[model samples]
Target: MKQHFFVLAALCFAACSKEPVLPANIPTDNPALPANSFTTFNIAKGNHYCDKTAVHVFSDSSMSVKVRFDSSCIYKTIDPGNQDDINKLVGFTEGNNNHLHSARFGWRWSDNALRLFAYSYAAGVRSSKEIATLAIGQEAKLRISLLPTEYVFAVDDTVVTLPRALRSGIANGYWQYPYFGGDEVAPHEIIIEIEEI
Candidate 1:
C-alpha cells in the first residue's frame, strides 16, 4: 500500500509540472501573427540609453512597450571581463533586467498568448546586443521561435525563418537614471526593440 501511494504521488507531481502559463489572449494553434514583420537595434547607434528611456513603440494602441539596460557601467568602473563582474553587473537591477541579459522582448495590449524571445548576452560575455521583435496581429498569426544551439531567433511559417542572431544572455537593468552618472554621463550601448502581437 505504501509503494502504491508513493507511485501515485510521483505520477501526480509529474503530471502537474508543465510549462509556465501563457497569457489567455493568445491562440494555441497560431499564437504569432503577421509572420515576417519585425525591427532590430544596433548598439552602434547613439543616445539609445538614458533616464526614462523608451526603446520601441508598437502601432497597436492596446499596448506600449520598452526595453532598457538600466545598469551603470560608469559607477562600477569595472569592465565585465570575468564571471564575478558579470554577476555583480547583473545583480543590481530589478524586474526583467535580472533575468534578461542580451535580449529584450515585449508585447502590446492586443498580444494575447504571443511569445517574444530575445537573444542577448552579459557585458563581459559577448559583443554588441541584438534583438528581434515580431508583430503578429493578423489572421495568419506568426510564431517567433528560439534556436539556442544555432543562436537564431526565427519566425516560422511553413519553414524555419531565421533572423540575424546576436549574442544571447540577460540584460542588467540596474543602472538607469540619476545613478548612472548623475545626469553628466549618458548610458552607452543601450539597445531597444519593439513588436506587436
Candidate 2:
C-alpha cells in the first residue's frame, strides 16, 4: 500500500511540473527602416477639414503600429467618442466595432492646411494634459530599431523606446493612412505611438 501511494504521488508531481508555454509571436530580430527615407506631409489648416499631400508607403513585414494612451490624458479634448474612431483613424475599421481608441493615430484631409493631432483624448469629464503635435512641414521618420530590450521610435533621429511588454507583441508589416473626423473646427493630422504594456 505504501509503495502504491508513493508512485501515485510521484506521478502527480511530475504532471504538475510541466513548464508554461510562451506566446507564439514574440519578436526576436531587430527591424530596420530606410536610410534617411521617410513619410513627409504638409500640415493642413481649417475646421474639420484640411488639405495634405500624401506619401503612402506601407511598413515592412516585421514592423507594426500600435496604439498607446496616457490615462492621465483622456477626456481633455472635444467630447466623448467611441473606440471605433481610433480603429478608423488607423485604417483598422472593417467588420466589427471593437475599436480601442486609446491606441490609434492617423491623418485627415480638408480644404486648407493638413491638420495634425498627435495624442488625442475623447471628449469627457476628464482633465488631460496638452496634446502632442508636430509642426507643419516638419519632417517625421518612423523607424524600428533595438536599443537593448526596448523597441525605439526614431522620428528625425529623436528616439523614444516603448515598454517591453508592448514592444514584443506588435504585429509586423501593415499599412496605415491619415484620417480625420470629429466636431473640431479644423483639419488635423494623426500622430501617435500606442503601446499595451
Candidate 3:
C-alpha cells in the first residue's frame, strides 16, 4: 500500500511539473491547403523520405514554390551538427541523369526557428548555406534561380547565393521532394505543404 502511494505521488508530480518552453509562433493546429494546387508531403516517423509523389522530369531555369510548415516542424536532433543538415525542400538535378550536379532549396528546424537553405551538389561535391528563417504555419515563397556560375536562392525578401556545378545551361533533371535526416530518421511524423509557382 505504501509503495502504491509513492508511485501515485510521483505520477502526480510529473503531471503537474511545468512543461519546457517552446519556440514562438508555433501553430497550435495544422492548416488546410488547397488540394488541387498544393501537394502535401508527409515524412513518417522513423522514416527518412516522404510518401512517394508523382515523379516528373524537370527542365527549368528556376524552380519556385510556396511552402508552409506546421508545428510538427519543430524537432531536436541527437547531434548538434545534424541540426545543420538541410532537408530537401524543392530542387532539380542539372544535366541529364546527373544528380551529382543539381540545385535545390532545403529546410530544417533548428535553434528554435524554421530555417531554409541553399543546398546543392557539383561534381559530387556538396555545399549548403542558410538562406532564410520562417515561422511555422506561415507560407513562404522560395525560389532557386539557375545562373551561369551561381545559383540564387530567394525566400520571401531574403536572397542567398551559392556556386552552381553545371553552368551555361538549363537544369534538365528530375524533381526532388521533401526528405528528412542527416543520419537519423524523423523522430516523429512531419508534414510540409508545397505548391509550385
Name the top TM-score candidate: 3
Cα lDDT of model 1 by residue, 57-133, tens digit = 12211112222222222222223232111111111122234233332222211122222333233332432211223
lDDT of 3 by residue, 1-197 (tens): 99999999999988896777645654324322333378788999999988854455677788788999999989988877788677787788875443478788888988789988888888877888887888899998888888887888888989988877677657777777788967888989999989877
- lDDT per residue (tens digit) for residues 24-44 in model 2: 664323222223233222223
Q: Quote model 2's TM-score.
A: 0.30
Regions more than 4 Å wrong, model 3:
1-36, 96-99
Q: Best lDDT goes to which candidate?
A: 3
lDDT comparing candidate 3 with the true structure = 0.80
- Candidate 1 ranges beyond 4 A from true positions: 1-47, 50-100, 104-119, 122-124, 128-144, 148-150, 154-194
Q: Candidate 3: deviation at residue 95, Å? A: 3.6
Clashes of each: 24, 26, 0
lDDT of 2 at 136: 49
Off by over 4 Å in 2: 1-134, 146-150, 164-170, 181-197
Q: Which ten residues in a row have the lowest lDDT in candidate 1?
A: 83-92
